[model samples]
Target: MALRTLFADPMLRMLVAAVLLAALLPARGEARDTAQLVANAAVFLLFLLNGLRIARRDVLAGLANWRFLLPLILFVFGAMALLGLGLNALSEPLLPPAIALGFLYLGALPSTVQSATSYASLGGGNLALSVVSAALLNIVGVFVTVPVFLLLGGSGQGAVGSAVIAKILLLLVLPFVIGQALQTAAHSFTARYRHNIVWVDRMAIAIAVYVAFSGAVEQGIWTRVAPQAWAALLGLVAVMLLLAHGGAWLTGGMLGLPRADRVSFLFAGAQKSAAVGAPLATILFAPEAAGFIVVPLLLYHLIQLVVAAPLASRLAQHPAGDGDCTAPTTTATDRSAPPR
Candidate 1:
């Protein structure tokens, strides 16, 4: 049943397909250039839709809950990022430098708005808070991830300079700002067709992955990375997952959060956003290096989904309440829709 649930995710299947397709027939020369351009456009559209969908009121609500939000931000970007640095140092001897650096990249990423909220809902968490917190984390991620990555010593083949900052502002931040500005006019349309629009997110991520992996393949990634290195990488990722989930849960308890909020924190603090990570990698790294840098994130995303399903099921069954572990009630106007 767990295996079925995992495979049933279309986004997951799309990502796997993207990786396999890149391996079998990676774009090169003119094709590579064309694919990169398409990926860029897709990323812009994706962020624009995010800005349209995330209500300003929700942002304010999340901000108002600073006690909950502050810790979460610190955990996702601070403690987790430091953990990534440790993992990178440990894995340096075992894996290639770029792939090892992926640990820090993964650590620095934001929580997944979709998966975190979905699983939080499934686990009988505070759905309203889950949606708002995860959305805000993504918003914060766009601004903070690059600086955090660089501060923690993450750099790709391409130098991060004025050009890169301009690209991020133009392709990512600017589009989101445009969406926010147009939100009053487009909110109804975005709300009405959100489920359909999830495809845009998935497709953008897939395209970015395909492009990054294509360059890696062109550079002979398979030959450069050894089988033993793959095993070491998986082992390291598992350790990081355990720490992420356990640490979040423990922190929530230490802070005396209600069970429902704890559930929300568990998922929100632990999961990383491939939606943000993949596209941002393309912007930050050269194509060949971006592929290796994203490898850890891709693997972590898959494993988290598999783990979250069963964990959520378990939590749902044992709603040992400091209060009922069901989603909090909120009106449509006040509630923020979780992004896919």
Candidate 2:
């Protein structure tokens, strides 16, 4: 039954298919160049859609809830990054250099806007706050993740030069700004067709993964990484997952937040965005390097989805009080378009 539920997820299936495809037939020579171009364009479209879909008022509202937002930002970027660094140190002897660095990259990322919000809603959390907080974290992550990763020694894979910085601004930040500027004109279109457009996000991520893994295959990832290293990597990722979710929940309780708000914090603080992580990796590292760097993130993403479903179900069944049952009003737009 649990296996059925896990396989039922289309995103998980797609991601698995992507990894298998990359291993079986990796792009090389000119094909690799073409694939990279397509991946970049897909990333641009993904973030542009994010800008068009997310409501401006929600950003303002989320920012005003500093009590929630400040703590969440710190937890996601600060504590989590440190946790990743600590784990990376432990993983160095067990895994390859690039793959070990993946832990730090994973921690530096933002929360998933779609899955986090979806789970928060399922768990009977403050849906409005969930939407705003997750979206805001992604927004902040676009700017902050690189610096945080670099500061924490992620640059050991490759230096983030000015050219890469320009690409980041052009490929990511500019598209989002343009989309936001055009949002007023496209609001109805975005709201009406959001579910369909979410495929853009998924496709972009899959393309990034495919491109990245293709490079890894080309560089002999299969032979370089031993079977025992794979086991160690999985064990390390599991530990990180436990810490992320457990720590977030405990911190929320410490903050004295209502149960609903605590649920929101749990998902928002714990979840990491492959939407942001995958595309950014392509720009940051060579394809060969990126494939290894994103291995931890890919595993973490799949595991989190599997864990969130049952955890959400349990939370729903055992609501703490009136606070857990209350549903705050949110814009239709906020609920409609969530970045995966």
Clashing pairs in 1: none
For 27-49, candidate 1 gives per-residue lDDT tens digits of 99999999999999999999999
Q: Per-residue lDDT of 160-265 in model 2, one digit per residue for the tens? A: 8999999999999999999999999999999898888977778888999999989889999999999999999999999999889888888888787989899999
TM-score to true structure, per model: 0.93, 0.93
Query: For residue 53, what is the lDDT in candidate 2?
Result: 85
lDDT of each: 0.89, 0.88
Task: Tell me the spans in candidate 1 whose CA falls farther than 4 Å from its real position.
Answer: 156-158, 321-340
Model 1 TM-score on a 0 to 1 scale: 0.93
Per-candidate total of colliding backbone pairs = 0, 0
Winning model by lDDT: 1
